[model samples]
Target: MSIHLENFKNNLKLRLDDNPQLHGFQTFKKTLERDYFSEVSIRICFKEAAKTENLVIEMDCNLDLLEMLYHLQKGTWGGNLSEEEDLPPNSSFARALDQLQELNEISIDVEEFSLFLNDCSIIVKKIYSNSIKDQLGSILSTIAEHYVYFTKGLSETPFEIYVPVFEDTIPENDYTLSKIREADNQTKDYFGFWGLYFDSEDDAVIYDLSNKSIVSGDLYLLNH
Candidate 1:
């Protein structure tokens, strides 16, 4: 049976209750809030940006995004001996941006991101890679520069897309804005933004995607 994005809520909650160690993965944001399992290796964030609630869920299982990140962090770029590698198969570029944009800002669930909440934990994941960023940026830049020539003033110019990031490594809390400053002084200023993390495969991929997959870009710049 093909799975839709409308069946993974109860399964998520059940995991939280069954796992004793997942309480540590609890997080909150401007409009979304929830708990997660770090071992299962999943993340859920509550976002209120875009005038909607976004329960962003990501699994770092068989194709864990974190694995690429760790590998890239350790100097494993292919082809040029430098430059971070691209995202694994079955990932989404837009979804990647959603996670980055909400790292330290208000949460948001807009556009094509509202079909993630349900009673199940698994879902088919779309693949994507940021290695295409350079290519993507170039294409976007060119489109903007040539918009006037093509549209003849019928359309506005293309603009640069800025992905938000934090200067620090962690944040105060990973739950919600209301609880970030009060969670734990030690956990503060350590890049503890809100997001649910699943440590189990069964708890993450209810639809088919490996529950352990967590896709992330290269946090460390490559040398090649």
Candidate 2:
């Protein structure tokens, strides 16, 4: 999904503004566990070296984002981004991301952590390189490495996003879930969970969060 830094900031501000006491926006990185996964790319006109620099800037940018998130939630800035950062527009952590804007670099202004940031303002969070690159690794692990697209700010926090329907959430008679114990059933009737293609080998490996599902085909819910 395309990300708008201003949109995120505005939404977050609105949410935080409405619920002033709700200081922290806790978003998990468990999206990888869902069945539906998509690729993310930037319209970067830079070369390989630029890519490297972009990566570095991304690194610092995330650090600052996280530090600020933590501070915002904790009600203190402390000294999180005090060190030299590798994010774009090299500068001290304190001066990196302008609160006026959601992101400082915004790589192609592309975003992967969009779902997590939806309607939630700044909370305790961190952005990382490995996490960004590898956040979808688990999803890719189930499929071909070359088939997926990882985005610039994929991993915004060390925590994982919550699966829409966790294994623990699967209550008996839930309709979608039949086999409770080691429940492994695959058939044309599997229509409850987020329908995901695990590998190129076949369409049999429907994605379930670790074992749960992402409430597949619920794009309609996004409206709310």
lDDT against the true structure, each candidate? 0.25, 0.24
Count clashing residue pairs per candidate.
60, 14
TM-score of model 1 vs. true structure = 0.20
Q: How accurate is candidate 2 locally (lDDT)?
A: 0.24
Tens-place lDDT digits, model 2, residues 1-224: 22123332343221111121111111111121111121211122233333221211111122233343343334232222333554321112212212212323343211122222222221111123323222222222221221122111232222212111112234465655443223133221122222222222222122333344323221101110
User: In candidate 1, which residue ranges exceed 4 Å CA deviation?
Assistant: 1-50, 63-69, 74-95, 98-181, 184-224
Q: Which candidate ranks first by lDDT, i.e. highest?
A: 1
